[model samples]
Target: MLANPALQAFSMFLVGTALTLGDVHSHVWARACWCLTDVLFLMAFVQWLRWPGSYGRKLESIWYLRWGGRVSLRKAAEIVYSEARAQESVWAHAAERMSLDKSPDGILCYIAEVIKQDTTIYGKRPPSTHVEKLDPLQLKYGTVTNGAREVRMRDNAKTVFTDLQVDAKELRRALHEVRESLRTTMPI
Candidate 1:
């Protein structure tokens, strides 16, 4: 599209003429519509050129981060494990020994597993842990959706921290283990 100088000049001329004439009720409306149609068509074409499942995969990663931020690594893991246990998955066995207030690391480990499984199937980065460094995925997806209230993780720190067992050492180790395991097990 950018390589077509005549098309670019024509679009610019149409736009400038339309603006100077300010004739919304005249042929300018048709020009405007055509311009919009062209832009949309180009955008659709570009979107179609993208890899299959990439958009949905990106959306899932983003949702995971936003939701993950609402809870600590510990609590997020527990929520995942709790859901898994309720479904009676074998992964739930990992969480059987720990109480909600006692196993932040276990939760982190479980969260890692949950994310690994997801990314394996979906083909995008997974939810990150508290100890994990921020990735391009997080940076891309962490922005608040339009008109949506921004959730501040720090403002909810008390609840998040409380939900977590808050053992720094254990949480650290859990994060490291999960990161390592995911690196090895997650499909590219």
Candidate 2:
């Protein structure tokens, strides 16, 4: 029901040509062009009905690029995923997940995976982070040492705080700090 003006005009031209030629004498080419135009108009209307306005517009733009041979299927898929990830709903879900107590470890693991993938893809590391420098200490020991800690501690028993309670608030704060640091220093 939605009509693109140019398509409508072309369809009208085809119809007029057929009418002038008479129904019985109409050329097959005129009938074919009209039918094709009608089908295209219907398809466009159906697509407009199917998607929300903004999404439909974005899809239409991408569709043009795809059929125009300006982008490959793989690149189109990557563009779609990037656009989807930037959506507010997606970001909200990510924020909620990252705010959880277990998320910091998962996030760090994901970052490590991304680093690995980037290295494999580009044959080099993507960028540097504080985690890169502290990773060895964190892996060898359970924690990283601030220089102040060495001055206050005499023994391994004194260095480790077994009684420390990490509540959800503290975990969330720690995750935020880590996220901020990574955002500042890394492309992630």
All models: lDDT? 0.40, 0.36
lDDT of 2 by residue, 1-188 (tens): 33464467566666757665776565676667666667766766765555434675667644644344233222222233233334423322343365333343433332222222212111111232211212222223332122101111234554331111112232233323333332322344
Clashes of each: 0, 0
Task: Encode model 1's per-residue lDDT on 1-188: one tens digit a residue.
Answer: 67544465566656757665785667766676567656756765665444234566545433544443333433435434443543444445544444242344534453543443323111112232343333334323332211111211223322111122223333334334443342222366
- What ranges in model 1 sit over 4 Å off? 1-69, 94-104, 116-133, 136-188
* Weakest 10 consecutive residues of candidate 1 by summed lDDT: 143-152
Report lDDT (Cα) of residue 62, candidate 2. Answer: 47
Model 2 TM-score (2 dp): 0.23
The CA root-mean-square deviation of candidate 1, after full C-alpha superposition on the true structure, stands at: 16.3
